[model samples]
Target chain A: MDELLRPLVPQVLGVLVRRGADLATAEDAVQDALVEAVRRWPDGFPEDPKGWLVTVAWRKLVDAHRSEASRRTREVRVLHDVAQGPVEQRDDTLQLLFWCCHPALTSASAVALTLRAVGGLTTRQIAEAYLVPEATMAQRISRAKRTVSEHGVGADGDLGAVLRVLYLVFNEGYTGEVDLAAEAIRLTRLLARLSPEPEVGGLLALMLLHHARRPARRDADGMLVPLGRQDRSLWGTSLIAEGVDVLQTALAQDRLGEYQAQAAIAALHCDARSADETDWPQVLEWYDELLRINPSPVVALNRAVAVGEVDGARAGLAALASVPDDVPRRAAVAAWLHERAGEPATAAELYAHAASSAANLAERHHLLREAARLAPDAPGT
Target chain B: MAKFLLLKHYRGGPQQRPNARTPMEEWTPAEIAAHLRFMEDMADDLRRRGEWVGGEALAPEGAFVRYDGEGRPPVTDGPFAETKDLIAGWMMIDVESLERAHETAAYLSSAPGPGGRPLEEWIEVRPFLEYTPPVVD
Candidate 1:
């Protein structure tokens, strides 16, 4: 029952908002409707759960408005008329997503609000996922809602904010009880269904392609397994196939965005039978396209790594010259390229430096091991 | 955000800075109270900022126990008279960045010491290993 009702949350909230309810009020009404559904659905499931939720939530909104004397100025009659009309089965989730990811809200606030309103996650769950206090997350959600109401719903044409928030959630990696990567993928899949935008498809494919490698990303003791060393058999073939199909379809649309280009690069990696067999030239071309679209230092750093794989280690080091020194993985990439170039001592020192500054424990451990392996007096040596 | 354990050592860590190694017992009572107060206030501030997960100061004395092989009872050893390294306390925090964790550790390291001066103790900032699988990307 919960699974059936989860996807309807955004739709119900969207209907209420379209019927003149404020964003906060609509969300509240939808939450109330959800609670009511939970209490009543055990006996039987409704044939039209989405419609039932929309109607019930709309009534709840009207009732709340009628009871609030201060808000009596709002035309309850117009709201009722709008609610009584034929229920348009239009996808309101996309509009609700746009509202939740409104530019007025900070990225953190946007992520929290989207998780709550669109992803059907509780405030406490979201807080736990973020490792912050429940009250802090609650305040953040309310503040985001207030900001969205003040700014009005953002234009639906741009899904950049929504995609960025989803990407952030995906990158948050697993920590708390919530599987945020899976949640992001789920939300992206839903967004792809609602919006035919090539970028939406691109984002979905990117997540799928990344997620396909989850099984081989960690070793038995929970240590990071770099892409080159991961067990190829553990990769999810079905997800890879689906991702490749999605990326191909999005590419056919002729609208190349950063996400599409990134997915294309990911698809190329996924298609490789082994690290040695990976088509670095094609991968580098995709990175070139990505850099052209979004000239971020992180992308530049990644491009340098790809360049190293395609060209000689010297060419890769030359590529690194274009990237800023302060990028998080700059030293680590340099270490890798230096090692490839037969400069083990320099590689070891850089690896040690990178390990000290690594934010993630697993990554830090991996870098330290790399340093140890490269050191002159290492045990095996 | 990431969770980090800022460990304050009783006896082990980087070499103490020159002119900064005064023992706690030798400090004035007022200075000791001020140091304790600073530690408490730091915890309070972290809680207020919603960054603190937990904190604890361990007793100076502790015993080491090991299980006996087979069906035998466990063997217990006395708290050693001296040890090279002893953990004093730890504060766990969930923060936005590694830099923020370092900043918090630095702040905690500034607890008042002998003559009401900053201790400047080295606080080891270690990230908690997340049990969850990493995202492949």
Candidate 2:
């Protein structure tokens, strides 16, 4: 079998699925075919691997039908459907993408399972990557699969949902052993290939733009360094270039969505040679669009930062005031706004509180850095 | 070196508030055995790496005692109602520092167990605050 076929297994599974053959059975049969290839292909290579696997999996299903009575009932008339030569390649992979990211699964499980089953990552590798025990990850994947299967969430038009899942996974700063950021990009590329949707392309661009600066997100002590303080020399220029190119194309399409709005925001950040040079007005405009679509408190909080940059700190604080007080990152955003407004005393107090109450290590470190920068003579130190 | 208590909490510690339970099907015996072996191997590997410390797993049932007026120790029934939140077991270790202690604990928590899942058992870790030795006058 061609080695490339391995990467395209998710695409193959997408193609095999019909209206009657349930997704679970299709996935199992695909795995069986892959296993058979692994066993037999040790000697040499095949001319057409995708066709080979499809043919083999179809046969395996027949053999399976003889013994498994329950599965036989669900099995539809799939004969010439197994032929894989010169087939009209519909964007079937997009359906698999959406199915894996169905809303029924938790955000974490959706990303993990998509990477595993769709991305063809081994369970152990996935577990190790995520800093989870293999058993725990296995159970998570299984549970996610069962949820999708039992809920009968068909592999239909769920591109938007999958895009959200990918974005959520990317935003979870890497605390676990996993290189979640890189994994997110890889999944995004696959999604982009299948769907070619503006939002999917936009997400890939946004992730790339953010990731290009990951080298500057931290310092020697593993403490988080904010975008303003980061050394621009360390940023991945090549990634930024690629991201800009993709985002420009997506923008040309003019099909605005949350990911596209986010990409536009990222594009503004990437365009700035220095943090002070950022186009805050443009970013604020994008955030307005994002808020209109997503309507999230977190988005509103982020929007305030851009407002502060564009319309002065007082204006930003007023914008933030409209947000519900119970928002998770409200204090952190308020602290930054206060600092921008030249109220160091209030900023320091808010930073101290936010640092102590931060949900994750990276954010806590970021808050502490901000606090320390403002109040070096504080008594606690 | 550092010491860790597999420290079952007595009280006043955070517990995971219940959330929706994900339904799972029963695993086959082979799956169960694979999970158990993974855990045993993990513990052995930790010990081989010189990370394992003295450990114990207490029975679910336990006894409690109270002293009153320093006259005599009052014996209480096993599992007194007041002792409902007592320590279940403890592990003691002398690690180089807190980071190493965390690494070891994370390892233990990741070990596979019954139900083909990593154990969800919660263990509290506390560092012993040094106390002044008694002086002889």
Number of the predicted model whose DockQ against the real structure is largest:
1
lDDT of 1 at A169: 88
> Candidate 2's C-alpha lDDT?
0.69
Q: What's each prediction's TM-score?
A: 0.77, 0.68
CA RMSD, predictions in order = 5.4, 13.3
**Candidate 2 CAPRI level:** incorrect
Q: What are the lDDT figures for the candidates, one per model?
A: 0.85, 0.69
Per-candidate DockQ vs. reference: 0.21, 0.03
Residue-level lDDT of model 2, residues A1-381, one tens digit each, is: 433655767766766665244576667677788887888877776777776776777666655664676455434335334443453466566677778888887666687778766876666666665544565566667767788888876536577778888776676545545566777788788777767679888899989989888888778887667777788889889999989988888889978877778877877887888988988888898888999999999899999888988899999999999888778678988998998898988999899889777656567777887788789586664
Worst 10 residues of 1 chain B by lDDT: B128-137
lDDT of 1: 0.85
Q: For model 1, how does the per-residue alpha-carbon lDDT over A1-381 read when each residue is reduced to its tens digit?
A: 656777778877776776667889888788788888889988888888888888888888888888875466557776778898766666788888888888877677788899999988878888888877786667678777888888886465348988999998898777867889989998999988878889989999999999999999988987788999989899999999999999889999998999999999888888899999999999999999999999999999999999999998999999999888889879999999999999999999999999888766788888999999999999987
The C-alpha stretches of model 2 lying farther than 4 A from their native spots are A1-6, A18-21, A32-43, A55-91, A153-155, A173-178, A376-381, B1-8, B12-137
